[model samples]
Target: MSGKSGASEISLKQSLRKIEYPSSAKDALNKIVDLICGRITSIKNMDLALDLMAEFVFLEIDRRGHKRGFPLTPLIELQLIELLYEYFNNMSNESARNTVFLSIFSGTTAIMRLGVLTKLVSVAIAIPSATILSSASAWMQQLGNTSQNSCKLAEGLIQDYFYFYNPNTSSINLVPSISPQFTANFLTAVTENYFNFTKRECIFPPKVLMESVTTWVSENPGLCIAAQQKQAVLPPGAIAMEATTPIAGLLRWTVLAPINKQDSQVYGDLHLALLNSIIEIPKVTPPKAIYAQHLTGPINPILSYVNDLRNKQELKLDQILNEDNLQLALDRYAQAIQVIYSVNAVYGHVDDLFHQLKLLPFNKLMSIVISTYKKNKVIIL
Candidate 1:
């Protein structure tokens, strides 16, 4: 084994050894395992580290027996799985939760930074005994730092898990996995915690993380391994095409759809102007429809903002939102979305933009408009 691979194995062993496995704890361990890995709970459960480890174990066992034609007697393997599950269950309750969460998150991050997941993935394919680690590594990749390498790893890993592609060998393997956002959340929280007391902005929950991942995958529409092997990278111009096209479509439809001749004033001319500004950037790919709903959802709060603004007739956005300035708050929220959309123009495909946009400077245009709005308390007349 390479030095790195040996270290990977040693780390995995150390992690497993950290939890106690008492003989009497088998029952509880088995229950938690079943719940986490075996479809016992369709709804609620914890993402305990032990649960992840057990999943790795059972998956490894099934993997070996399934493909290699090894005889894992159902009765014996089943009982072993059950017992192991119970052991992990009690392990979770041992006030070890604190130690476990930190260790798993931090360890996973280190493993990823060292590029260990690729080797772990290969081992899983060969022995099938390593499926546990292999699977965990997939989630582990998602939970890594948000650098260019990390984004590529997460995007490729997830596409591999969902679509099942072999990253190194350029082949396909079909296995299901977790949602992208959950993966991002784990990495983001842990990273933010680490950044505490630092002046550098936190990295988790990147404003464009999910959007960029999904958009790149959607626009390319190929298996993960193929892209990895070819080192396929798109130019920024193509990225811009993917980013704004959807928004352009939305804008075009709004224009052709005709003003509401009936309740004309409800949505009225203001939205038309907003939509027009958005559509002007022709190539922008709009957010995915589902996510777009989230971006636009804050708009609904503006109804109350509008009502309050009308009562107070105050257009000073900074002063208003700062002091129950509901309208300004909504605009600020919209402004954030607008910023994301504009930044999307650049990060549309480049990996490290996750950090770059956080540091995006030059708010000249936004500042000018905001200054005017605050000066006059512009309330759309």
Candidate 2:
């Protein structure tokens, strides 16, 4: 859901004067963030308030286009956030900040204060191979050229956190601990060039804004963030919908648990039983997701047996999977994929599907795209 693109081209920032923040508006049409921030009901409301705040922010930014220069709007954003801190501390209600709000446009504003929604927006508007870092040096130079004071102000505010809070600093140094001035320079380039963002070009902020929630929990002193821990995940008469596809449960465990050739044998056998069970059922098959429920309850413990054998490297696995088990497992996995994947559409040239696939993977599965187009040749006709 929060994936990124492969490449993108930057362009000019939009010249439109008013930002169309999504749906809810926090303040009056003439209001700025500072005006209503102090009047918020409670921290719980403040958390819910972010959705509305995002609109105010976008609108204010949109309005700034008519001004003579960059506002270097650090004071503006900081004031809004500071208001948020007070709202959190004083709230009597039970809205959890971490669970409720992750910030507007996720990482879009990471050029400034981007939070989780930055990635969500990127996913929503994704174009392949899009990254903000690739051409940053030239981009920085362009920022220097914008020559607008308001743009400069926004840049200054934008870069400070990128300098400190950047999680992207794991290895490469894309952004040298930039100064507010340096950030201003970058923002100038962005707005002046009008951010020529291609479908592939997505802005990536260096951080995912999250508080150490456990710390928040401990520090809060009295109750918990979400309904004082009294909330239930499911109400009465609810059941978790069956999962049709493989979802990596835990990253570390998945990384450690690669499916290799040996495990494939065991994996193969389990699949067969599943397939056999499904084929025996009547005419119209159930949804793949619905079938998945059968996998967990009926087949999971069986697979868990193999999992243990594989993990402990028990010799018993060698005896069971080698002959009969392999055929059974392969049958099941194939059957499942067959039933599930068939529901999706497939279209391509009929003449040489194998050859085309051998030569070109689909764009959905690939970064670069190639298609043949007829052209006139100057060969002595």
Candidate 3:
């Protein structure tokens, strides 16, 4: 072995010596194997580790052949996966977290590449065992701060789990191993805890990671829209909303995300549709007591502002251009917009009076008059 490989092996050995495996024999054996496999990178070191692991496997088989107590490598593999899941929750140093994540992610994908996870394990456990880690890594790589090398490794694994594309069968099918949002929640956790990304930050996953959701949404467009409408009832910071469909979450997250780019125009229509389709807040059939009290607050403002505007419209051009009049006009316009939003929040049906107001000349004049007043007020002030 080269000097670096020898040093790595020595480091590996020192780390193993420090590990205090729990009293359970199976747990202890699995921990030792995990430590050995996770540390050795060189072929020479790997050969030694493999020999040691093989000897342990044979000894266990001999000792418990009739009892069926040989350790399940697949189960051990799942235990190793916990290290990754835990890292996302803890506020560890970024460099250390990335190193640990990349190490396990790369090792798992390498094992996956050899078909060891599928071919060695029984079919019942095979698919799910291979899928859980592989799918999680796919989302992490696509959404997290991953190296190009790590991304390439994750891409290969994603092909196996996201959509099982088979050349021999000439068929591509979505894998039922995991939901898009289940893995997406991992990203949300890591970004929130590890990266400190604020809720407003737009962390768009790579296109490959979103393919399954986008494909499903395309097929069930109506259902997706209905799901989003239900999602709208919950507050933006709602914990329950996370249980909704992944597309609904993504749509709300990317409410301000740009869809005008050349590559994104394809989704612009559906995105806009979902954006506009969310149900209005303060339900149309609110309790009479609440509506009566709340509605007046906004309705009173609209009445006052509209009457003020009518009085101004009758003023001479010179009077309308006065500094005080211009300021009042600007203030009232601002108040009008606020009340408009408030009224819409309460009675948001198409046939509602405010909804009809949007189609009338008054709404058009408000837009034109607000702009003109803002300009004239600037000069007067």
lDDT of 2 by residue, 276-304 (tens): 42333233333222222222221332354
Each candidate: how many clashes? 21, 43, 0
The TM-score ranking, best first, is 3, 1, 2
Error of 2 at 270 (Å): 24
> What's the CA error at residue 310 for candidate 3, in Å?
33
lDDT of 1 by residue, 276-357 (tens): 4333323435423112332332232334444565477765645544443332333333354444354342233322322232
Superior candidate under lDDT, 2 versus 3? 3
List per-prediction Cα lDDT, in the order shown: 0.33, 0.28, 0.34
For candidate 3, the per-residue lDDT at 365 reads 40
- lDDT ranking from best to worst? 3, 1, 2
Q: What would the per-residue lDDT of candidate 3 be over residues 222-281, giving only the tens digit for each residue?
A: 333232232212112323221222322333223222211212533344343433322222
| Clash list (residue pairs), candidate 3 | none
Worst 10 residues of 3 by lDDT: 287-296
Model 2: lDDT equals 0.28
Clashes of 1: 21
- Per-model C-alpha RMSD: 20.2, 22.0, 18.4
Identify the runs in model 1 with alpha carbons over 4 angstroms from their true place: 1-91, 94-98, 104-109, 112-156, 162-181, 186-368, 372-381
**Model 2 alpha-carbon drift over 4 Å, by segment:** 1-75, 95-248, 259-381
Question: Model 1: what TM-score?
Answer: 0.24
